[model samples]
Target: MNGLFDALERAAGPVTFAPGATLLRGFALEDAAALLAAVDAIAAAAPMRHMVTPGGYTMSVATTSCGELGWTSDAQGYRYAACDPDTGLPWPAMPALFDTLARDAAAQAGFPGFQPDACLINRYAPGARLTLHQDRNERDFGAPIVSVSLGLPATFLFGGIKRTDPTLKLRLAHGDVVVWGGPARLRFHGVLPLAHGTHPVTGAYRINLTFRKAR
Candidate 1:
């Protein structure tokens, strides 16, 4: 806890991308503990597992979700499902703290009236990397994507609209919240492979909570 607090105290201020993405550094500093507690409860209910992509490759990142709909992928491709495929039960409801944090983060990023119905929790261990890709599975494009980072530090790959376009590596630490919408909503983005390191709050793994309106 002390380590996390100290790190947050040293984090940089907000960063705004040209395409409308906003990174609110250390925005979740005070709420991180409660946020993590909520994550633990959600994981206990749904459990985290690596889902296979349509290409039949297993993702290195373990994932789970809470809220009205959950993002899922398999040989069939990516889609939003109302219930967890494993348990055939609805995923745990989104925690109130989680909801409030997301909404507040979005508002801070200039997207008011944000109401996310799906929160995807991704766990990344050392060497885990997510390929650059655009998020387009959701029904509404008007809503922005609010992502919260916790635990280990990560290099975020913020790319242009095209896959071949140039990308910028942004350092994201625990408590950093990034909100992207409008012109930046569909831009390609991903996380670089995590290096071997440990965080006080989450040990060696990093947890990312991505909230979206995925009706």
Candidate 2:
């Protein structure tokens, strides 16, 4: 048992099980205020909305995007596009701080040279939730997914390939960054309904920025 545990620990990838998928605490929050400011700016330009699913159901969480590509879902289906369908305009450009954080986080997780081209920003209010789903919209699964948590905390559900597979619930706090790729690239994941809370920075909301290589 010790040998097996050691082997798993020595695996050539990110593996920090804090009773959940993985937990890397206090990764970096130096520029969190700046990042949130940038988010507010983007939101002002392209307001976040509860996008409709292909099945016509409005999502519980409000979403916006930036970078070269943005993830969108509608009757056409979930996919990455160069512009926001709501407005015939390109999504906001990826902020330099975001790009730097993603690349640095990926490198820390053992996937270096990561250059993400899409960043999906999600805002979750009290009672908002995200259903379990795989992030397969990207053209390449080789690139890792870097998710940054800000404002109110959230419970993240990380599952395996099969939906029925048992999942680990992770408590993600503000300024936490979670990176997954390689064998965990296609893992199913989602967020449970957020509990009521008030954050000084976000004011009763949870903001998540997920960076991906959409091209």
Candidate 3:
């Protein structure tokens, strides 16, 4: 975190909606350029592809990943993989900046010393949406999830542990970051369909970087 980002974080003041969940507005603005560049490079190496759920339905979001592990799904199930199913090689190494940003955001949210080994990158074009789901595939639920948003804006759906619980609709804009853990670690969350808009950085799509300790 630089001087500018530190100021931005201070201004945002860690908006908390749950016991262990927080939203930091414009937390990544200072590093957005470099971060987006790294994202482009990672996607170029691994290539983004729509994965099929265990139910055999294809996902609307196009996703790729980086770090020691990558998240994937197919008819088999949703799980973490060491290699990109497409490239048949290890996912691109996590960028140093990504690690730094995740840890800083986690610390800001009151969970210190976070180390993420997996980063799942999702691309949402117009009409793309993610249904509410828990980040339960990880072996350790102790580690928090650090999510950064870029490109277009999207509505984030944050719900309770139960599937039928009411949800809070939070609008997430470019450069925003959300960290959830502890009691909120298992909370169900997702994104609404992205609206049609061109972003200066990502054009007509929204990009989400989800950092997790999948091992």
lDDT of each: 0.92, 0.85, 0.92
Cα deviation of 138, candidate 1, in Å = 0.3
Worst 10 residues of 3 by lDDT: 1-10
Q: 8 in model 1: Cα distance from truth in Å? A: 15
- Report the alpha-carbon TM-score of model 2 versus the true structure: 0.90
Cα lDDT of model 1 by residue, 1-215, tens digit: 34533454465776575468888998999999999999999999999999999999999999999999999999999999999999999999999999999999999988999999999999999999999999999989999999999999998888889999987777788999989999999999999999999899899999999999996
Q: Candidate 3 overall Cα lDDT vs. reference?
A: 0.92
lDDT (10s digit) by residue, model 2, range 179-211: 888888888999999999899889999999999
Off by over 4 Å in 1: 1-11
Q: Tell me how far candidate 2 lies from the true structure as C-alpha RMSD in angstroms.
A: 4.5
Residue pairs clashing in model 2 are: none
Clashes of 1: 0
lDDT of 1 at 83: 97
